[model samples]
Target: MITFDQVTVRYEDTAEPVLRGVDLTVEEGELCLVVGHTGVGKSTLLGAVNGLVPHFTGGTLYGRVVVDGRDTADHPPRELADVVGVVGQDPLDGFVTDTVEEELAYSMEQLAVPPATMRKRVEETLDLLGLADLRHRALHELSGGQQQRVAIGSVLTAHPRVLVLDEPTSALDPTAAEEVLAAVTRLVHDLGVTVLLAEHRLERVVQYADRVIHLPGDGRVVSGTPAEVFRSSSIAPPIVELGRAVGWSPLPLSIRDARRAAAPLRAALSAAVPPPVRPVPGGDRPELLTARGVTVAYQGVPAVREVDLTLHGGEVTALMGRNGSGKSSLLWALQGSGPRKAGTVAVSSDGPKSKDPRKLSAAQARQLVGLVPQTPTDLLYLESVAQELDQADTESGVAADGVRARTILDRLAPGIPDTTHPRDLSEGQKLALVLAVQLTAAPRVLLLDEPTRGLDYRAKSELVRIVDGLAAEGRAVVISTHDVEFVARAADRVVVMAEGDVVADGPTTEVIVASPVFAPQTAKILSPLPYLTVAQVAATLPADETDPDS
Candidate 1:
């Protein structure tokens, strides 16, 4: 059990408190989910429970915060290790060991858990978190999702009564996020561990939480059951929105529930009108960027074998596969950040080979390509949002600073602020800001690595729309993402890479609907023909007069 009694936390020299007079309690065996827009102190709230706020961050604190019967001020992170376990958004930054099994056993070893007991715990954790298949993999060798599971598994090895996660699923795809959340839900149902998690993807976790906590940017705590809290707030899951539209009592909590409630309504609507069936888009045109017989190596081992692939302008293409499939490596090569040994990579736009990304001069390369890196904060160094955008605008030379940044931000607004500190924004907002700046550069081809990893459904949709619009403008858009829903909605083509080889390529619907490993959306699976949107489905249904059975 944990309690915050009028708790207020402020960082060093900061005038405003990140947490303002927070009074809340999380009881044993309860799962509490924290949701809010960017810069709402969700991460700060998690810090209070683990004593990382004033201790690690060095801030001013007011009022008493208690966890597991000990005052947070009295017990530091190390002292509270037995009572609380904390996992952060970035698994790479949190990795303490080289291998998966060692990382999982590190905490127990520190607790002086018996060697015999530690071994047993390690095995159990691997099994519980579905890491048995990857137990022998190197930390750097794992995928984003696998690395995240190992991070949480390392903390779970300590057997803390309370598990506090800050954006635990931020780096995961839908399937991976589902796996991590299912494991967390099992802890609450089977092990009775109290869970307090902060995340931007409310639709994925809100249904599982017993209570919901909202922290607006204004510094206040909004607490109640999920339906009660979300009903009063501006944010909630898609199912909740559908519930409001269909008048479902208590609100549909899960997609399964939503589907059930939709069946009758869909039947009634279908009786009146038949659903439309659209054809899949045409095959990709000529390649904008092509790799022929390409091979890459690292430390004497082959990372990418002889492979051939093409990216076309005015199309959205995705690179996907399991962990260690060489998806990221290929992207690096395309960005000219990696060595190319045995093949040639060519772009459609006219340029000298020396002006190519692989061997180009600085200015020449800047005129060719723009990349949104996987880590949102890695490229951001400005003090304020406005300055970051202004610098980007000036370097781009396409438009005036005031004109371009304002246009982009307004399009991406309700989530990002033009005047807020880039560091103070949520992970999703920070990514969007950097991406908006990247778009201003006006490159022929755009490379986005895991673009939707941390964003909520709304943010994800907005980003997809932006990419779609860009593709419509005839820019080659290559996105490396695991969000199947996003891929289904936006991609015109799909490329599958596995173990450094080009395994598959085709139209988006054909590739996703045909692949056995990559799961498509439920609606896409249910409908025989391609159906990406509800509006599309609404327009296709046949009229009631067409069918006598209706």
Candidate 2:
């Protein structure tokens, strides 16, 4: 259904091609997964499927990309609209209509389908993706998860034979992610729809993929079965990594297979004491911020209500919840930009300041707290990355020749040219740039909202180390995320919210291990051991010794 023949994609700005010598054939009805580090050619490769690479993105294509025997070089994205449907990383950018139902039908209308057929397909697609309840909701008003569902529905309504998705479930909660994946799989099995997908969350879709494609961030594409690729790939899920760490034969690609091999490991870990969860009391550490009876409302509707919270120095706290559970609102309210109906928020800057964050000037607010929002690119507006860093230094009152911001960005993602445009950088690179820009402020309290949205395994690991390093420097960190695996490795405390109220708050293991919904892959396999990460398991295991008989 999809074939790439010596396909090389190059942009004029950079010397290297995003994708080079990518030759492959994806048979019809097969769901192919593309995996790689951030800034690799995964997105570029996805765009080539429907001719969005050189056609829409204004890049140069070296070879032919054929989808359903239609050369992408000859057909633009609009021409292949009936053959291929591409859903981008951000769903909001894909919408053409105001409401969910209208967006679903708009594609069909563009294709000049019969009104009756369009209406029927729209309803069918809505029900297939569990978007029936949101059919009437305005596209702008929906949650991130809902917007993702709507994006998929809008594409599926066109009844295209092939679907190209970029991080389809990155915005969804666990339950929503599973449902969306299940729906995508059903298209392959039941309707024979071909799919080419790219996702960093391997644990969610690795087991369901028929084949895996690895792009190692060097313009190379390696294709094989999931088991074959993950066996030695640097980018792998916790499940596969655990198998590799313990020397399990035929490395388990899924949790079920991992469990069978985990029996012995589980027994061994049961004998070892897991790291004790320490209770961080308000008195134990310096309180950087304190909020009492904080309530945020929108149009007389409460999103966050009477929430009392405290941020302590040398702590990393993770805020987790469903899509509409006020996670973002809580972060915005705490940052002092969002609406606060009622409450008192105080920051310990120099002495103590108990005023609303909204009242503080932008410069003053940064000194107290700094936020890296979900859409990291929103914080960047300069033409080039170098300019962004220079402006960050100036805004933060750093030395004119200061390389502190540049140094931080290099640590997050190396080898990015200073002259590269911020928009031209890959999603992960963009995120790293934004994070570095925010860190230049050196605020007492740092908030990262969905920090792992576009990061790969390695990038996430780097972020974990950075977060740990920051907390060790006596700076308080709060992260709002749905990436449970990341939370397990990076956060010391877990705060779960539901229906705009704080439902659970405790140490990481005590909170996540107890709830099946939020548990990491390793925690699920090594149950009853209170383990949350593969690193923890590796540390507990006894190294092999030489046998005297040998």
Candidate 3:
């Protein structure tokens, strides 16, 4: 269904092509997963499938890319719209209609399908994607996961032969990510629809993929079975890394398979103890931030009810919940930015605010707290990455000429081009840019909402270091994420919310390992061990036992 013959794409003002001499074929009804580091041309390759690369994106293409026997070189995205359906990382940015039902039917209308046929397809799509209940609801009213389903259904209604998705599950919680993946599996199994997509969260979708395509940072691509590709691939999920650590032959791609081979390793580490987590400095440590009676409402319906929370000077907190369970709303309210029907949020150093937090000026509130929203690009308005960093350094009053901010950005995601536009960077790179911009201000409390949405394994490691470094410096870090693995490594404490209330809050191990759904893969594999991360498990085992060549 898709073929790339010696394809090479070179964008303007760049010395080297993003893709060099790539040759591959994806058969009909097969799901091909493309994996690569951040900004390493995975998007460039997917864009080439529908002629969005050289045609719409202004790049030079050297070879042919064919979809459904039609050369994309001759066909633009609009011309091939009936054959290829592309869903991007951000669903809200692509929405063209107000209601769910209307958006699903809009594509069919553009294709000039018969009115009866369009209506039938729209209903089927709504049911297929489990969006039947949201048909009449406004698109804006739905949560991030709901909007993703609608976006996919909108393209599916057109009855395209091939489906292309970019990081479909990045913004979703564990349950929501499962639902979306199951829907895609049905399309491939029940309808024989071909799928080509890219995702950074391999742990979420690797088991469902038919084949894996590994894109090394250099201009080389490896295409083969999952095990074959992941053998030497630099980026891999914890399960694969676990298999490597224990020297398991035929490395497992899923948690179930990994658990079966973990008997010895689990037993070996059973008697061992993980290093104690650094204390959050509570005895003499002052309360850096506090919230009481925090309630956020939209259209008279409370999204976050009266909740009290506290953050210490030195600690990492994980705010976790299902989608639309008031995670994002609470973060904004605590930052004194988003709407708060009733609440009191104040920074201790601000000297006891007699007035409401919502009444503070934008500048004053920003100094007390800074938030990196779900869509990091929203905080960036400047034209280029360099301009954004320079402006941030100036506003931060750091007396550095873009030196400090640039240093942070480089550490977060190395080698991001200075002249590149903020909108032009990949989802992961955009996240790094916004994070750097906010950190320059050095707010007392830092809140990151879905920070690892598009980061590869290596990039996430860099983020882990950044988060740890911030906490070590006595800054409060609260991260809202669905990545259990990351939460296991980064957060010192866990706070779970459900239906606008705090359901559970305690130490990381006590809060995360106690629950089944919130536990990380390593925790599941080595059950009853109180271990939450691969690093922790490796640390517990003696160096002589975990040989890769054993």
lDDT of 3: 0.86
Higher lDDT: candidate 1 or 2? 2
lDDT of 1 at 284: 60
- How good is model 2 by TM-score? 0.95
Instruction: Order candidates by TM-score, high to low.
Output: 3, 2, 1
- Weakest 10 consecutive residues of candidate 1 by summed lDDT: 541-550
lDDT at position 529, candidate 3: 82
Score each candidate by Cα lDDT. Answer: 0.75, 0.86, 0.86
For 331-401, candidate 2 gives per-residue lDDT tens digits of 88889987888888887777554555678998888888889987777888988999999889888887756
Report the CA-based lDDT of candidate 1 relative to the real structure: 0.75
Sorted by lDDT (best first), the order is: 2, 3, 1
Model 1: residues with Cα > 4 Å off, grouped in runs: 11-17, 133-137, 268-286, 297-305, 350-356, 381-390, 401-426, 501-504, 507-530, 534-550
- Give candidates' CA RMSD values in order: 4.8, 2.7, 1.9
Model 3 Cα lDDT, one tens digit per residue, 121-226: 9888887777888899999888777788898889889888899999988888888788888988888998899998799988888899999988897776789989
Better of 1 and 2 by TM-score: 2
In model 1, pairs of residues that clash are 274-541, 274-542, 275-540, 275-541, 276-540, 276-541
Task: List TM-scores for all candidates, in order.
Answer: 0.84, 0.95, 0.96
